[model samples]
Target: MELITTVIALGGVARCTSLYAAGFSKYRIALAVAAGELVRVRRVWVATPDADPFLVAAARDGVVLTCVTQARRLGLWVLSDPVPHVAAKPHAGGIRVTKAHVHWAAPLLPRHPNALVDPMENVLALVAACVPFEQALAVWESALRRHTVERGALERLPLGGRARRLLTLANPFADSGLESFVLPRLRWLDLPIVPQAWIAGHRVDFLIGQRLVLQIDGGHHVGAQREADIAHDAELMLLGYHVIRVGYRDVVENWPRVQDLIQRAVAQGLHLAR
Candidate 1:
């Protein structure tokens, strides 16, 4: 019972060496395995029945789950959840490479011999290299918002190229990944865009200039939420603000039309305080 409890405490999965280091005798480990208290993973690791499948697979393949894969696991927003993105040591050999994006760069921090997940620093670096610019920035901002990694700590690292550039643009104010997407596309307009700005007792997604409020309805905008947003838009208009409400598809799939709408609004000085 104690052995099973210890395994569960060790994140439901642990290397055999870690277990031994914790003072479990080899005979006790064998007995636990034989009694079905633990399941052996590829001879070196053992896991409880309810271990995270992703971590289990990482252990089996001798890789650390990193990049967008780890980002999603950390509750940071990712544009998409594709196949697993795992990291292996640059010189690692005989790894199981099947249906997963393998990152072979040296990690920014040393990985523990028994670790199944990459450090947050390494995850951010890999995300910068793996995904497109906007997508990577969204993930980075999400990390900042979640306090998964400190912005100063990330900046202090000896980052280069894309990672450094993305850090420069990454801010913690985005309410959603969609906000991350919208602000950068409109940055070239040389207008001030404040995200999650408070106005008229509610928060707008993006406030461009002084009076233009952009509201983004993400997946959670439905039924009462939709009605409430409509009410807020009405209130804003009555108070002399222009509201441009957009859906996920509008901002994502049909962005050109959305940009045109904003440009027309700005052309008429709608963004200016009336």
Candidate 2:
């Protein structure tokens, strides 16, 4: 029971070396394994029955979960990926991963031998390198908003040019990934696109220029939330704000249409205060 508690404290999985160093003898561990109190992963790892399957897979496959896989696991905003993303040493051989995107670039931080998940900093670096610019920026800004990684610490790292550019643009104020996606695409308009801007006692997604307001509806915008947002739009319109509302699909699937709408609004001077 004590051994099981120890393993659970170590995140329901632990290396034999860690177990040994924690004062559990190999003989006792073997006895526990025999009695089904612990399950062996590959050779040197042990896990509780309820251990995270991803970590167990990482341990068995000799890889660290990284990139979008790790980003999702860390509760950062990331586009859906059907396959797991894992990282292995550039020269490390005999790795077997099925239908997974395996990142072979050198780690931003040295991975511990017993680590199943990549460090947060390393995960961000891998994300910057692995995903597209907008997607990667969303992840980075999500991390910033969640306080998972600090901007200053990231800025001081030996980041590549692409990553450095992303670091410069990443802000901690996006209420959703959609805002992150919209800002960079429309920055070319050279208008003031303020995110999470308060208007008439409510925060809007993006307040473009002086009067054009863009409200992006996430998955949570349903039923009562939808009604409230609509009411807010009515209120903004009453106050002389031109409101344009969109959803996940509007931003992700049909961005050009959305952009055209914004551009036309700008061309008509709708964004100008009357």
Q: Which one is best on TM-score?
A: 2
Q: Residue 119 CA error for candidate 1 (Å)?
A: 0.9
Residues 113-216 of candidate 1: C-alpha lDDT, one tens digit per residue: 98899999999999998899999999999999889999889988988699999999998988999888998899898999998999999999989999999998
- CA lDDT, every model vs. true structure: 0.91, 0.91
Q: Each candidate: how many clashes?
A: 0, 0
Which pairs of residues have clashing backbones in candidate 1? none
Residue lDDT tens for model 2, 38-69: 99987899998889999889888999899899
Q: After superposing candidate 2, which stretches have Cα over 4 Å from the reference?
A: none
